[model samples]
Target: MRISKWGDSLGVRLPKAIVEELRLKPGDEVEIVAATREKLVLQKADDRMTAFTRMAERRLTMPEDYIFDREEANKR
Candidate 1:
């Protein structure tokens, strides 16, 4: 596969055969598990629980009295 310029980023256009074999569709997320000068490896991204685990590892803290307001968070 060849990488081409995509707006401000580089992108590879996956061949139709690989796309069909992987069952990938537009907007599906992928993770690059490994890369080297000669090789690149990609896998499907983990689900929400993995995201939460990574977030927890960041050790983010908030004020004890803080309360989450769904409406405020959803504001555009």
Candidate 2:
């Protein structure tokens, strides 16, 4: 793919074959998982619940004395 100027940033237009293969549609999001001078890897962005589920699977632990302040969270 050839990179072209997009406003102030550079962008690449995916060909029709790749678009169909990936089942990509307008407004769909993709993330660049890895990049180097000669190579780049892209993957579809995960949905919110999928990300949350992955986080849950990690089974992170909190401090025993930690407390959540609902009012503080709500303020954010």
RMSD after CA superposition, every candidate: 5.7, 7.8
Model 2, range 1-76, lDDT digits (tens) per residue?
8889989999999989878877889998888899999988887676865666776799865578988799999999
Q: Tell me the spans in candidate 2 whose CA falls farther than 4 Å from its real position.
A: 53-76
lDDT of 1 by residue, 1-76 (tens): 8889989999999889867877789997788899999988877666765766776799765579988788999995
Q: Number of clashes in every candidate structure?
A: 0, 0
| Model 2, residue pairs in steric clash | none
Which is the leading candidate under TM-score? 2
What lDDT does each candidate get? 0.81, 0.83
TM-score of 2: 0.60
TM-scores of the candidates are: 0.59, 0.60
